[model samples]
Target: MAIRFESRTVDGVPLLLAFPDSNGAPWPTVFWFHGFGVDSEVHRPELRRIAEAGFLAVGVDAAGHGRRRLPDLQERIDQPHEQALRTMTRLAAQTAAEIPGLVRALADEGIADPDRVALVGVSMGGYLVYRALLEPVALRAAVSILGSPEWPEGDSPHQHLDAFCRTALLSITGERDENVPPDGARALHRRLDEQNPRSVHRYVEIPGAPHLMDGDQWAVVMDEMPRWLERYVLRPAHTTPSE
Candidate 1:
């Protein structure tokens, strides 16, 4: 079935909302970030499926992609732009400014759990989530698929991974990935474990998954997310049923 599409203004920026009918009322919500590319972040089928799991899914193109109607007020990102280390980092921070609006819109529609929202970002989007939230506390949980964190001035980006994994994050990397490398992911895994140590972090090296996962892997990763949202985001912090 075709996923229904909707749109609205967030801080004067056009953001896209998608959902598939699963007959569930007031689904949880996930703010997803698409990987870097010229591909339209618009109309992503997987993103829309969040609705089918009794949750709403919201996504936006950074100032440049898709609708192209947001304030690109941040410093101009470098070219191939997203490829430029500095540009990507700047764009990630700028995009974070818009998340509040995205959350408000979905909550106002009454299509999502106002308090049970989560974030799932890929590539640049993933990195942005880390840079923006500094932790996954804003939402229920965050799935960062191959997202790398950029270090502060005079620091290597890789050096910041530990401090960056400050949430219930599923840090995934391909065992043979060249872009981020297994060692980098491991370094991140160690830092997250050392910093938070409460098991909020899960590092998985796909037997050989690359920058992006294939169909089977994608399906598995997507399906597992709803459960995570239910446990961490939807369920209240501490409510045990009336005795």
Candidate 2:
């Protein structure tokens, strides 16, 4: 079935909503976050796949990115690597904090099932997923592609790992990803495993892939991510009767 797409702005946050052609109320939802400098539209294919897998997929424009680019973006764009990292850290944190409210708004509008919410992000979006885990949102699962639990100087990504241990997590990265080193991804998996031995935690390393996935690598993601969410989020919900 072809997925239908719509553009919406909820309380100043620009979003792209995707769902199957069938009329389904309160569909299970996955909030997608794109990489730096990219807009939600760039992820239409992936979001469509997610919607095909029985999810109402949503993609949001990160602050100062995509259509939300600021007028003074050139100055921030020219900043040093560390400075840019700091800026991304702050933005990711702020965006993470706003997600719960956004989810609630979606639920109120009868567009999303709040109880089955999940997150999927790549690169900076992946980093935002990590940050979002720190908050008290009722996220059922999360997939972080080319993301990590490390932050710039003065930031502590570890403190939240324990908090995140309660939710199912899947962290994927390229074996040759220079932007987010493979070692860090491995270490994050190890830490999460150690913190919560009972939770479902899986780490995947795509061989010969880079920070940005090519068509084949993305195909792998398109296949695996929905399966992961189905296992941890959808399947369980299907078996459990609503209160």
Each model's lDDT comes to: 0.61, 0.81
State the lDDT of candidate 1 residue by residue for 97-187, as single tens digits: 6777767766677776656667777776767666655532355566766666543333344555544433466666667666555665577
Task: State in Å the error of residue 43, model 2.
Answer: 0.7
Task: After superposing candidate 2 on the true structure, give the runs of residues whose Cα lies further than 4 Å from its correct spot.
Answer: 236-243
lDDT of 2 at 198: 66
In model 2, residue pairs whose N, Cα or C atoms come closer than 3 Å (at least 3 residues apart or on different chains), thus clashing, are none
Candidate number achieving the greatest lDDT relative to the actual structure: 2
Total clashing pairs in model 1: 4
Any runs in candidate 1 off by more than 4 Å, and if so which?
1-3, 20-26, 39-43, 69-83, 135-137, 151-166, 237-243
TM-scores for the candidates? 0.76, 0.92
Q: What's model 2's TM-score?
A: 0.92
Q: Give the root-mean-square deviation of each candidate in angstroms.
A: 4.8, 2.6
